[model samples]
Target: MNKNISAGWRDFHASAKVYYLWLALGWVEIRQRYSRSKIGPFWLTISMGILIAALGVVYGTLFKADLKSYLPLLAVGFVFWAFISTTISEGCNAFIAGSAYIRQMPLSRGIFVFQTIWRNIVILGHNFIIVIAVLAIFKINFLPGLAWFVLGFLLLVVNLFWMSALLAVVCARFRDLPQIITSALQVVFYITPILFKRDMLSKYPLLIDLNPFAHMIEIVRGPLLGEPVPAVSWLACTAMAVVGILICLAFHGRYRSRIPYWV
Candidate 1:
């Protein structure tokens, strides 16, 4: 892990123009995502608004929950779920998607993984507006200490970065991984507390303790709900991130050059 970071640091510093290159690629990603749409980025806003409305009207009633009471939790949970879902799903193709560049250019392989994460963050930015709008309309009294939520978001991004690095290398060589990962993510969606309140786990406290996704989502939403942070879970996830980075770095260092051939 240390070796990979050292190498990455050297590579990053050696190139004076890497920022310009990454910025250009990031901008291109933004354009490519919205190129065919008429209204471009607003499509994200519209899609999320409709989905939330549909679920709020449909599932909220089916679950016998009040729209005003549950909509805020649902919206926030769904938005963060989108972040985790897309980052991993896209990470599986991060290397494959940039095959042309990997083969033809002398760019760092890490850049592609970073680009995937960056693009997902941009998409999250668009979807976040819908969450904020929903929270406002329903008059949900979210936490006033905004800094904690920001801290949680930064950690979430850090976690996604680690996941992307590992998956990008693994799926580069094993291309079918994307489909399998997407399927697993679908199952995770149901088990995650996206459509229900956290208190629903009162009788099933074991479920709360076992769910990694639950902890991940809670780190971000707990602050928003005026709840206290979970220090133990946060530390545990940080350890996982460290171990994940080691594994990913070992794999990436071994196969970084082979990526072009695989792609």
Candidate 2:
């Protein structure tokens, strides 16, 4: 067990040594995705802008919230949520999706995970432009909390690394898991306080308080929306990152070598 754990940690670190290779690969993926398209990746920004505008108006009116305030929140929330949700849900297929590379060459499995996160980071950059526009239109002062937003984003990336590691291994072994993860994420989306404020469920704070996704979203969305940093979210996410890393270390140590076979 100890040797396996050590090996897993070593493999994870070794993969980071080739960060540039995978990062470039990630960009290649984005470029290929829009190879012939004129607007390229900005289509993500345009689509997100449309969603935010349409949903913000409809949900704001339905919930009796002000558009000036709610639109910025929705825009930031959706951008972050899209990144988070896509990273996690797609992470299940990380190893399986890279089956060709895993079998044809001797490469670090961690590269695939990093590629997934990096690809989403690129997409997030595109989507975040919409959030900036919404904030500007609403006159929200996001510059004041820029430091916290960066910190939160870094922490979120840490969380995603561990998450992708674990899911990559598990989903490779269990073929049906990708579908299950998709369904579960869909359920989590409705429960998370993205479209609706947590205050609406004031009577049952646990709904949001106990949800890691809510905290994940809050840490990033809070600062962008000019809201105070939720200390509870910071602490919760930090703890989860630590725990997730430990779990990934153990899981990968025991199963990392078998990933290619499974795929």
Candidate 3:
């Protein structure tokens, strides 16, 4: 058991040392995805902008929300949710998608997980343009609490890395897990406070309180909207990251060697 833990830590450390390789690979993926398109990755920005606008109008009316406030909130929530959801969905294929490389070289499996996270982070950057636009148009003064966003985003990424790592190993073996995860995230999307505010569910406070994603989104979104960062959110995300990483490390360590065959 100790040897397995050590091996997992070694694999994680070695992958971190080869940051250049995965970083370049992630960039290459973004480029290839938009290759030959005139606007290139700006297409991501455009699409997200369109989605935010459309959803903002529709849901804003349905909920009788003011466009001014609702649009900005929706924009921020959607952008971050995109990063979280896509990273998790892609994580399911972190090892399976890189089967060729895994088979051809004795590379650390964690490298592929890093690549998956980095790629989505790049996409997140592209989508964040819409968030910036929303903030500017609404004149939401975010500078005062920008520091909290930095901390929150870091915690969000750390939690995502562990999620991706754990899913990568498990999905490589199950193959069916990716579809299941996708379906589950669809349900979670509705439950999460993306399109609406938590106060809307005043009677069902537990819904938001129990949701880790709600806390994850709140930590970042709250600051950008100039709302005070919730102490509970910070505590939840911090505890989740620490506990999730430990659990992921143990699971990945036990199953690391089996990934090659599974893929």
Candidate 4:
């Protein structure tokens, strides 16, 4: 077991040195996606802007919440969710999708996972414009603890890396897992406090307390909204990150050799 764990760390260390390769590949993938398009990734910003506008009005009226409060929250939530959901869903196929490269090149599987993260992060950058605009419109001043947003976001990325690594291996081995993950995320979206306010769940506050995604969202979104950083959120998210890292390291070490055959 120790040998396997050591081998996995060695593979990851080797892969870390080739950051430029995966970073370039991730950018190239985005460029190729919009190679012939006039607007390029801006199309994502436009569509998301429209979706948030429509949902904000509809749900705002439905729930009788102030647009001033709800729109900004919804906009930020949508952008972060896009980053989180895509990272997880697409991550399941990160290794399998890169089978051609995996089979031909001597690369660490970690590169493919980073590629997936980079691609979504680029898209998230585009959506972030809308978040800033919404905050400005609402007169939400930037707070001193805004630095916590950076901390929370980096922690989230840590969790995402482990998740991508684990899922890439698991889904490569089990063909049906990608489909199951998709369905599970769909369910999670509704349960998460993105579309609704936490106040509504006053009777069952545990719903939000128990949700890792809610904690993840709040830690980032709270600072953006100039709200107090929830101590529980930071604690829960960090604990989850540690657990995810252990799981990913163990799995990668044990199955690193088998990935090529599975893919």
**Leading candidate by lDDT:** 3
Candidate 3 residues lying further than 4 Å off, grouped into runs, are none
Give the range where candidate 1 is weakest over 10 consecutive residues by summed lDDT. Answer: 8-17
Per-residue lDDT tens digits of candidate 1, residues 1-263?
67766665444344334666656687798898789878887787788889988988888989899888678778888889988998999888888988888889888877777777777888888888987787779766666847878877877877787788778878877877888989999997887788877677688876766777787898888777666767866875677667766666666766676888888
Worst 10 residues of 4 by lDDT: 1-10
Q: Give lDDT per model, in order.
A: 0.78, 0.89, 0.92, 0.89
Residue 191 lDDT, candidate 2, scale 0-100: 88
How badly does each model clash, as a count of residue pairs? 0, 0, 0, 0
Better of 2 and 3 by lDDT: 3
Error of 4 at 15 (Å): 1.5
Error of 4 at 69 (Å): 0.8
TM-score of 2: 0.97
Tens-digit lDDT track of model 4 for 1-263? 67777877888777788999889989999999999999899998999999999999999999999999999889888889988999999999999989999888888878898889988888999889998899888889866657889998999898888888999999999999999999999999998888998778889988899988998898889889888867999999999999888778878999988888999
Task: Write one digit per residue (lDDT tens) for candidate 3, span 1-263.
Answer: 67667778889989999999999989998888888999888887898899889999999999999999999999999999999999999999999999999998999989999999999988888788898989999999999989989999999999999999999998998989999999999999999999998899889989998999999999999999998877999999999999898888788889998998999
Provide the lDDT at 90 for model 1.
86
- Where does the lowest 10-residue lDDT sum fall in candidate 3? 1-10
TM-scores of the candidates in the order shown: 0.89, 0.97, 0.97, 0.97
Q: Which sections of candidate 4 miss by over 4 Å?
A: none
Model 3 error, position 146 (Å): 1.0
Q: 91, model 1: CA deviation in Å?
A: 1.1
The whole-model C-alpha lDDT of candidate 3 against the native structure comes to 0.92
